[model samples]
Target: MKCKDCQFCKYEGAGIAGGYKCKHPNIEESAKKYEQLKRKVINKDYPHIGYQMIKTSLRYCPYRIDREESL
Candidate 1:
């Protein structure tokens, strides 16, 4: 099966654990990259701000927060 076009799979497995893509090359690469990113953050003991920092600091990112409309 093909990966999800939502493309969020790119961020899975830092314990990201969201949508899954059924055994596709793209998903495999994404999981690998995510794990590598997770390790990098751990090695550095976390940073100040941004994706890299937050990635290492927290298990998951806060960017997953949903936007609320004020209408």
Candidate 2:
């Protein structure tokens, strides 16, 4: 199932730059880490560190809940 069809999917930003992210409580810790990494990349604080992207398995996610089912 796609993230856009999941109840926990949250959209951040607006327009073409907007993206979907899972907001499930179980993944909160990893989400925090992702944010920290994103900030580091944007600020260029760690020259040795390369840009890291958050990888979420939306296709077969165990935590995924159908939006229609939730409603």
Most accurate candidate by lDDT: 2
- After TM-score superposition, the amount by which residue 40's alpha carbon in candidate 1 deviates from its true location, in angstroms, is 8.8
lDDT of 1 by residue, 1-71 (tens): 11223233343334434323232324334334545655643342121122221222123222221111122
TM-score of each: 0.24, 0.32
- Model 2's TM-score against the true structure: 0.32
Could you tell me how far off, in angstroms, the CA of residue 59 lies in candidate 1 after the best superposition? 10
User: Largest TM-score belongs to which candidate?
Assistant: 2
Clashes of 2: 0
| Model 2 misplaced regions, further than 4 Å | 14-18, 28-60, 64-71
How does each model score on lDDT?
Answer: 0.29, 0.42
lDDT of 2 by residue, 2-71 (tens): 4445576665655544555456655544434544645532332211111222344432233432332356
Q: Deviation in angstroms for 9 in model 1?
A: 11
